[model samples]
Target: MLWRGRRQSDNVEDERSDTGGSGGFGGGSPGQFRIPIGGRTGGGSSIFIVILVVLAGWYFGFDPSQILGGGDSGGQITDDSGSEGGGAGAPASDEMKQFVSTVLAETEDTWKGIFQANGLTYEDPKLVLFSSQIRSACGFASAAAGPFYCPGDHKVYLDMTFFQQLDQQFGASGEFARAYVIAHEVGHHVQNLTGILPKFNNMRQGMSEADANHMSMQVELQADCFAGVWAHYTAQKGILEQGDIESALNAAKQIGDDTLQKKMQGYVVPESFNHGTSQQRQTWLARGYKSGKLSDCDTFNNPI
Candidate 1:
């Protein structure tokens, strides 16, 4: 990966300190509600917690309103923050934090160039580093639900522990694999900027559960392709070592919905697959890596 010693992003928010003051989880203006950290309340804390729970539920295939005891919680949820352990918090090491910041800066550089070439301005997104649980513009989330980008806030929420899980649980070790995860989430931010996410969400509104899942698969696959696009640029800069691409491909395969479902339930259900199969993920990522063109990432129109 060769990420160390590179420029680190100033857009990173280190909420791991847990010293209070909104935690800067999503980098947005203060909202009405905020999460109660350690029984603390006020200053818009309760709403953040509600939003985090809802967002986490959405990632884990559940309705936030249902999980939060119906839709009566009048406030709009936003942003994220959290600690480590089963809920106990811990700060991320300086090396890991620096590594993430470096990766994020590279992605910013890559995307900014690509967007400029396409006659579009690139907006840098803030990356939030949290522990066990965090709040986001889309809602709250835990490390268990994996990394995600909140379109509402245009920020990427990451729980560093997910890197450990990626290695120990998914067997997708290596710096490139970790980079792929960050890139994939940043890809979602790109989608938000390009209006793909809003359009997809609108389309999914009237869809059946199976149909919505299919739409989500396209969205996720496109993000994977975007990640590969970033990788293509990095490779051209001669920063990628041998086997770097393979590590990313292995990661894509390991996180496929089919593979995860089989690992969890001993079976695969195609209808419920929102993130595509292992082969599809690897193939789309490869397509972007080979072509290095945004036009090549039209997962919705093209067959996977």
Candidate 2:
């Protein structure tokens, strides 16, 4: 969590100023990114559509290229314009922006080393920082949808306000917890690079709603494990503090599908769960942290 004074990623994009219009697929202008928000129902295809649409871009692994056009496979970061922001229009105090960039840089370093060791090249992903809403290749997303990775654009979209929500609404606090959130989204980027996401999507084609949710859970749990893998490297480099792991674990527990559902509805529905239960999330994350190997994060082959 000792992030300040560390290296900040050049791939960080400040799109907070680009609010007020939407322009990608759903129509509007550049900054006016708005999407329909509806109440969550307990049954029928409406709920299924909502879940699919939300999960399509919700946590990870929906190829926006299939829906949005031209599939670009490269990992290079392109600016909203052609040139990079020399830190222009980043966070005002530079506190949150600096923290995010540092963590992203560290993840880049860690993943690059890991990929090289495995005889593969690591492609660094750009992190887009937006305000209330943003238009991604996947579609339009609001801050309420939380942070997500779009495989189509090869970018991680994050709304920093989610950090406040994590602390106030979800009861997950601390810098490491915030770092875990970034790492988890980056983990999805990793999965995309590994071709795991496409395979999962293909497999989900003929699956029932519940079955698809289970597959999605596996994908998300694997990302959590990848986050732990990043944490393992940070710990090895002596960057992680004493309570850092605990902070991340608490975060994993706090955002579990089971926990969130209970908080929202005062009950739990197992079949509708897509991100795994609290125990499953914590277990996968802990497994990666303890093992520090990509093979250990094979949530698809192993049961949760």
Candidate 3:
């Protein structure tokens, strides 16, 4: 993608070198509790219970990331009634920072135009470049949690190292693939603004485990489609290079529930699929790319 020399957003804040604050990992409101991914637990849990929670999460598709948060430590799932999280770390090079800002600026432009056409205003989400860990409105998060968008504060938190992993660990590379990651998270921001995220999240509370997994799949697929919509507009601007679309599609395939599961566990569990299969992800992404219209991204109502 021809992102350099393009408009760069001023909304990015880099906090990589600021890790020593808030007692290193356990600050925030008194009542705020975190669900650490696999960190130490204050209320120690046996590995058996940890395995159970992981199995439960896999079986019911209950959660993807609300597991290990921080300071108030545990390997179990925690309620979402907490404040932000994160710590200080190293920085990505200046060029990477520019790349991130440029991509974010493009998303701002694309979404703003779409929202205006739909008679709604667009709010630009703040993008934070942190190293290793960071605090977000949704609670504490580490780089292991990957890139995420927090609806509570309308900000996207990124650990740039994930880009390296996307290439080396997941075997997906190319700048546009990196851009797709950012856009996918930003898509969640769009869902939040559109009330789709809140509605679905609330609806999941009373839903059966399988039903909630289905709902979550819709939510995630729509975000992938939204990323494609962003790509659609981005391509029209003459910035997309040959094979750029394939790069993004490859990234989608690499990170699909089935692909990741097979890679990690050496087998597939169909019922635990909350993010759709590789073909489904690529299909939805391509569907949105075929038409830039937001109306084309009805993953919830249509068969995703």
RMSD of each: 14.8, 9.7, 13.7
lDDT (Cα, tens digit) per residue for candidate 2, span 119-223:
567798999999988878767877777787887778888888988988898888999999999999899888788776655655566677777777777778888
What would the per-residue lDDT of candidate 3 be over residues 1-304, giving only the tens digit for each residue?
A: 8876665666688888865234334433211111111112111110112222321212232221132222222111111322111113212347898788878877877776555544567898988888877876666666776777777788888888888888998889999999998898899888778776666555556666666666667767878988997787777667889999999999999888778778877887766667677888898899888865555666655765
lDDT of 3 at 244: 96
TM-score preference between candidates 2 and 3, better one: 2
Listed per model in order, the count of residue pairs whose N, CA or C atoms clash below 3 Å is: 22, 8, 13
Best by lDDT: 2
Q: 225, model 3: CA deviation in Å?
A: 0.6
Each model's lDDT: 0.66, 0.69, 0.67
For model 1, the run of ten residues with the poorest summed lDDT:
38-47
Worst 10 residues of 2 by lDDT: 35-44
TM-score of 1: 0.76
Q: Which rank order by lDDT, best down to worst?
A: 2, 3, 1
Q: Which stretches of candidate 1 lie over 4 Å from their true place?
A: 19-93
**Given candidate 3, what's the lDDT at residue 303?**
69
